[model samples]
Target chain A: MAETPIRFGILGCAHIAQTVSRAICLSPNSTLYAVGSRSFEKAKKFSEANGFPPSAKIYGSYEALLDDPDVDVVYVPLPTSLHLRWVVLAAEKKKHVLLEKPVALNVAELDEMIKACEVNGVQFMDGTMWMHHPRTTKMEEIIYDPERFGNIKTVHSIFSYGGGDDFLRNNIRVKPDLDGLGALGDAGWYCIRAILWAAEYELPKTVTALREPVLNEAGVILACGSSLQWEDGKTATFHCSFLANLAMDITVLGTTGTLHVHDFVIPHEENTASFLAAAKTGYWELVTGMSAIPSQHVITTDLPQEVYMVTEFSRLVKSIKDGGSKPEGKWPSISRKTQLVVDAVKASIENGFEPVQVRV
Target chain B: MAETPIRFGILGCAHIAQTVSRAICLSPNSTLYAVGSRSFEKAKKFSEANGFPPSAKIYGSYEALLDDPDVDVVYVPLPTSLHLRWVVLAAEKKKHVLLEKPVALNVAELDEMIKACEVNGVQFMDGTMWMHHPRTTKMEEIIYDPERFGNIKTVHSIFSYGGGDDFLRNNIRVKPDLDGLGALGDAGWYCIRAILWAAEYELPKTVTALREPVLNEAGVILACGSSLQWEDGKTATFHCSFLANLAMDITVLGTTGTLHVHDFVIPHEENTASFLAAAKTGYWELVTGMSAIPSQHVITTDLPQEVYMVTEFSRLVKSIKDGGSKPEGKWPSISRKTQLVVDAVKASIENGFEPVQVRV
Candidate 1:
């Protein structure tokens, strides 16, 4: 019997949808089945521009696309303000969700989205592409090695990119209504997730926002940082900004090992990823030099990270449909944990940079 | 017609003195003239093991080394508690002082040391070797380049090393009476200095110690971190530990550039040092990847860093002796500022992790 590919429906013709649209076409387990935008012309243009197959359908309204029985999964790339409406509607229509982040404006909205997916018995996942990359798993192996890595001590992550004059002036991310969380939601989301991931999904006990985050005239965060403390004395710090040069990095320190990756959010190449690792390193006589230099580990993948993300989401959807497996709760749980930390950081920032307890 | 080398006296036979003694010999304008310890036989063994010249004088006590008029400069590598008494004696005896890090227990003690050097008209410089390396000047070029580096936004540094079970129990760094600041003084001194160096020696406005710094049973810091914020919105964070792998790194992020060095405290190699630098970087279209990778800049130094440090100290001493120039105040000032920030961080930790305003 031929294996059936999960069909994808994309809501909105967002700029991110262009990349994910290509990913949908590239993923072996998923098909670019339908696209919906307020203007049918925009959906058609997006499909044609991004190599959508001729069999792919287009609709003027998201409702039409979600109503299609063939859209086994919906990838919603709508603005934060519109997520609650469209994501809940997609769930009610019995479609699995592969949602783009923020995930929502706050935890309350995210809870609703998760609840809707739960009630509909559909898989839910955030569009955090890096998590699905093979290199991540490879790095995880090094981090968890007891003899080499030992117990975790500290982790630091950053995701900052230069936004030109035009972006600072005109981008929706700089506006309060469209993407209200600003850099905290856009770039900081990845930094928080990376810290949480390095800590093995253990939520931090406290989150304190670093002082004086840069904000736009509309009060949207342009740059911010936070320090998180765990119950076990492990510590993590993260920074995110749209004002600095493009830099995405994570440094994980353990009792005996240290790991560094310069591009964790987006690999420099489509096929290969690299990270620097050092285990049991010591200084030379007189502390003039290191006993051994850190070695770089490169990982090659058959598929790009975006495609990998789509494939993973599709695989989860297929498990429920064909394998009689329940919807995977891990994905939504990760997203929720990430959102809860984000809320704590934002709260810390709002509350005069006081350390806020992470309640989740 | 010939330049006279700065004569040197060793104040104690500490482990670090073995390295600095060799550096004094290697430095062109310095001579290691005297060695001293309470146990004359121990001092004699150290001098023999570390290749002290046959002409070098050995003394039964540190006061004998300081009292020797031929000893133009005294290099003090004693534990923190002994620094005030011995260094003050050396300075008062009209000998220039080249002291080890954690120059004193606090800023107040550091001020006394600095004042002794000032009143006695003797050059005062702490033995922070990396600052005098040629590679430091080369990296400084990139950091100060407005076209490339722009305004510094953030600086993150770490200097951590592991201690074996026996060393953890016995090393001076872990002992409250011997080196009261523990890791905060040993490793954190370099971390704080790196932050200050990257910030062009400007003291931060506030220092907030990160929560839950690991302390030993003797109430000495084993691992700790702190965040500093400057008035100009630039921020920095550093972590120092005796409980983690050997990792000395500095990550400086600017508006238009980023600089990364895995070995800021001590390079992985002796003669060659490298740093990763990227200027005006951006993401590739659709955020698929970075437009350019950070290039590695290798700097070759003919002299080792410790040798450079010694040569610089000797040159300052020579300028005062030969050219009748006043002692340079820059080095002592840098030490004072570093100690001030260190005091603030320690105060914050002791005061239940409150944000402490840097008095400087």
Candidate 2:
């Protein structure tokens, strides 16, 4: 084992930062190194409340944390509107980025962040924690199995939460200047990522926005959906909202099999996650019911998925630090593809729900 | 109790009739009274093979069964193209109609059939057996309970079954003049009905067909989908296909709760059905996972859902016969509403995937 842990510095006191803070503490290869907020006193309070070690630094500004030589990685949990500026600056300071989702306002902004990380030789990975879960790897194995899954024919994903009157009116996500894409960027980001993940990151040929996307008074999307069609004739549809009950579903249907994960964004249990799969299932005699039932597969981990994400990021950062290995290309490649689909969907919604081609 | 059981006369030897035939035998309030086919030998074989009693009649022509005074209900399982002619004739003979769905190729045809039933004082119900499942009632109780489900916001239903090469080329559903609308009228009919049922029979204001529907060479839709928007901002989307794995899903999201039924079309087991419901579910502390997991509720019945459908149809007929009641209006009304949505989806698909207003 390495003597020094990859040090993590948090950029904000955002709600999601608390989760990442716990994960950084749980990861054996990483440590909570610092936290920065606009107010030094607020940063101190947050650090104390979240179990920061005595040696961890506290800074009054994000720039202060970026300038700290001890901070090897910065987990950016700021709003999408602030991601481009902070992430690029952090990369210029040679800090690896494990950025929160809806990484930027648009693909152009995300491209700039990616280039910054590339220029500085720092790793870039989105904070989609579910992708790091062991269950996700198991699901990918089944989806790619030629004998069982066959060719994927259709995919449907939904990620939504009832953002009550308070969040709808007061949250930064609903404000046009804060998270301009609104629910499409917040809840929708996971759905798009799930679709791209199931399709093996092969970009769709065209994406058409579903009609009547619900938008707030500030023209921020409150709820929206889109359909994507691939050149191989595979298709997908996803719905995201801030106005419905909490639901996270990813149902993928291949010609001979199906995969259903009701709580795909987050598992019901932290230690174990499960998914249902049916391969070559059939109907009962006379069609009274199904002949073979779907089998539930459970995957267990020693740590939560967020911890796994931190550990993975720290592993890459360590490789770059001690092993002289180049940064991993898989993480940012998938993130860029997911963001490309998001851009295409937004374009379709803006251009009167027309079909917009997805360009890499 | 009425001394006489409702006698069911089946028209045509369609494969679906085999399931309904078993249902008729299992239903306590009904009996398989007769069968008709274009050939006498075929009618005799169908009657003998499907548990028809020794006294049951076999007719060479459908008109012969319709004219029989002993047949109180005619279960029409003929191809959809023949429904307009045979259903009108059966209703004219004062027979209750347990018609297979889609009840007609279009709502106009369905309206004609409904008028014929009303003029003759005969009850009319479609063969959507899942609606009669005890589990369905339980689901409605939760979805309708104000404290549990709250106001409905969005719904999604998917019903798809993969069709092999032989099925695609040879099935009556693929023949233009036989089933005409193909999978849309077959599988999509169930999806539309489920959406209407969840929304309490309220028709959507606009229906837009998803683009790039897969169609056969004869111009029959093999796979299709649509999005519906209600005037009150309630929305629904459904996908029906003959090119994916068999999947029957109905996921409803209310303001405070969610309801999920994976095998909504047919239960995975003959003796029981289940659904999952989560009310006011929340995230766990630190956002590790769901705070409250959804609980599975199972309902068991001695008879299959198809038998329950037959028993319910017979009860309605017996009410008109024994209780001196007019034919119940509920069945035809819901059937018409389902057909209206089906018609709207079909029109939208035909009209360049435009948003067509549902004219109820």
Model 2 Cα lDDT, one tens digit per residue, B1-360: 656889999999998999999999999989999999999999999988999999999999999999999999999999888999999999999999999988888888999999999999999999999999999999999998978888888898989888889999999999998889888889998899899999998889999998878998999999889999998888889999898888999999988899999999899998999999998888877878886577899998998999999999999999998898898898899999988888888899889988999997
Candidate 2 segments exceeding 4 Å error: none
Measured against the true two-chain complex, the DockQ scores of the candidates, in the order shown, are 0.78, 0.79
Give lDDT tens digits, candidate 1, residues B1-360. 867788888888888998898888888898878899999998888888877789889999988888898999999999998899988888899999999998999998998989988999999999888998888898999998888899999998988888879879999988999999999998999999999999999999999998889999999999999999999999988999988888888999999999999998888998999999999887777777776679999999776799999988898898898889999989999999999998999999999888899997
Identify the CAPRI category of the predicted complex in candidate 1: medium
Query: What lDDT is obtained when candidate 2 is compared to the true structure?
Result: 0.92
**Candidate 1 ranges beyond 4 A from true positions:** none
lDDT of 2 at A267: 90
For candidate 2 chain A, which ten residues in a row score worst on lDDT? A284-293
